[model samples]
Target: MFRVAVICLALSFSLLHAETDVEENDIDIEDESELRSKFEKFKVQYKKKYDQAEEEKRFQIFVENLKASKRMQEQDIGTAIYGITKFSDMSDEEFGAFYLNPVISNNNDPRPEEMLSADVAEQLTNVSLPSFVDWRKLGAVTRVKDQGLRCGSCWAFGSVANIESMWYIKTKKLRALSEQEILDCDFRSTGCHGGHPDNAFRAVIQLGGIMSEREYPYRGRNGHCAFKQSKAIAKIQTYRNIRPDEEEMKIWVAHSGPIVISMNATGLQGYRRGIIRPGAYACDNFRLNHVMLVVGYGTSRGYPYWIIKNSWGADWGEKGYFRIYRGEGACGINKLPITVVI
Candidate 1:
């Protein structure tokens, strides 16, 4: 009797274990089904089409990216929201190749020897900086632009953005400048692969001036130089590199106009909206990768942030703009504060 009872007990234990396994498998299937639904919606929302094999591959990547986004959301110290974006389907390497310029992060190009004029320097020195400044609100900023895929021409876009703001502030006329002109003509740096804003500034000076977007439109690819000297509307004689201090940067932006800056864009991969205060470890101060325009600065929910204009289009990150924590030099923002002198 004892032997029969022991046999029955072992069989019951085995059946219970099998039942547990089946339940876990059901949960996994449900999870995968949900993910598939989300992926289908994502493709539809972004207008993405893929072959059968490529679709499977991209769905896997999207799953991994979603996991990473969740990790980012959990780890973020600020109010940043991380979720599906236009880049959700891409792997990190593919995303970096298409959007970011890693070369700019380690750029060691020689600075121009030109200095700010004495009068301009005196004016900047004496002008009292306001607690907040928004070039967009002041009508100095143009509409946010989109730099299409596989073209890492952020340097040109950033440089042109600052120039447009400076030109508007000086002339009271805002005109969209051509980034393709810089990509085509600026031989100092590689065109679409990557370039520096300083090189772009020098290119503008050498090319005499930059033409309006109407005359030389953006093609999102490299092309032969088609710049017409006669069509040039705005010009810059020189550019100034500000000291890597947030206070000085604010003063400069308040008195002059928007400034071009480069910073680590790793955190931006998962960024959707809200002021990004990712803390120091999440966004390294030394690993700069993407260049952008600093159009304004202000405080939000007791956190001071820098308003940055991005080249990723109007749909991404606060209408093609983002804000980062100001005082801590978050993501190496203060490392490369540069602006053209109009």
Candidate 2:
């Protein structure tokens, strides 16, 4: 009877070990499934190969980007922004060269001596301001998202876009102005080689305003200005440089219309979407680079931010716009805010 009992105990222990092995095997399968899913996402997002030996270098880079994105997601605490998992497939270097136009390729950014300057046209010192404002809600922004497309002509795009919005606000009619006109004609700016939107505004004025997109067309390259006084369909009464104060800039954006701005967009390279309060990085105020248009300002999850429109196509960001941490002079948010008074 004692021998029989010992044999039964040994059989029970063997069954327990078998259950433990099954559990461990299940965990291994789950981990592999998750990794496979990540690899699939990389393939679709970057349009790259997952198994090809010839593409091994790019595959390794994509994996590294994917891991960095995962780490960022895990480490960042309640950042009030959306996930960057969408950008997991593209390396930071690839993203920057494709979407960023902070500095032009062959030309230098305008020296302080060369940068165009506009005086403040109006100031709302004590006006009651709204808690939030979005020009898209006002139908001032266009639905057709513009694309800078590997060109340093973002300055021109921002300049033309804001002016177009101003024309809509003033005339209640939307007109697609030609950014190519500015890219080609604005000698002060170097087109794809980079330049200031401040100089871009000056170019529009010098050409007696700009022509419609249908007339001038965007070439995304620098060339001699083909000024056609006949095709000029939109004009700005005057352009102004908004005060560098955050409060005043809010007043201008809410009361006036959309405004153009140049800022240190270097930090925007890693951004995928969401209210981009740049983590672990601060923009150099002295080195303001890329130009963007501020369509509005508001709070997201109790964190105040500015809604900025980029020319890098809708596929790049939050339907062509992104939010940045507002106030505290984030990335020099209020620096060189340019808007037309039309």
Best by TM-score: 1
Deviation (Å) of 4 in candidate 2: 89
Show pairs that collide, candidate 1: none
**Cα lDDT listed for each candidate:** 0.76, 0.63
Pairs that collide in candidate 2 are 104-193
| lDDT (C-alpha) at residue 289 in model 1 | 77
Q: Candidate 2 — number of clashing residue pairs?
A: 1
Model 1 residue 171 CA deviation (Å) reads 0.5
lDDT of 1 by residue, 1-342 (tens): 000000000000011111111111112223888788788867766678899999999999988888888777767777777777777788887776666645432335444445423344545556777888998999999998877746777888888999999999989999999999998999977777777787889999999999999899988778999999999999998998876678778878888889988888877876777788875487777767788899999987888889999887776667678888888888889877889989
lDDT of 1 at 162: 93
Best by lDDT: 1
lDDT of 2 at 141: 87
| lDDT digits (tens) for residues 1-342 of candidate 2 | 000000000000011111111111112223646545555544554454445664565545545654554444443333533232334445666655554534323433332422223222244444778888999888898753454345667777788889989999999888888888887888865677666666777888888978999888876656778879888998876766665677777877888888887676654544555675644544555455567889999886888888898775665456657787787676666756767777
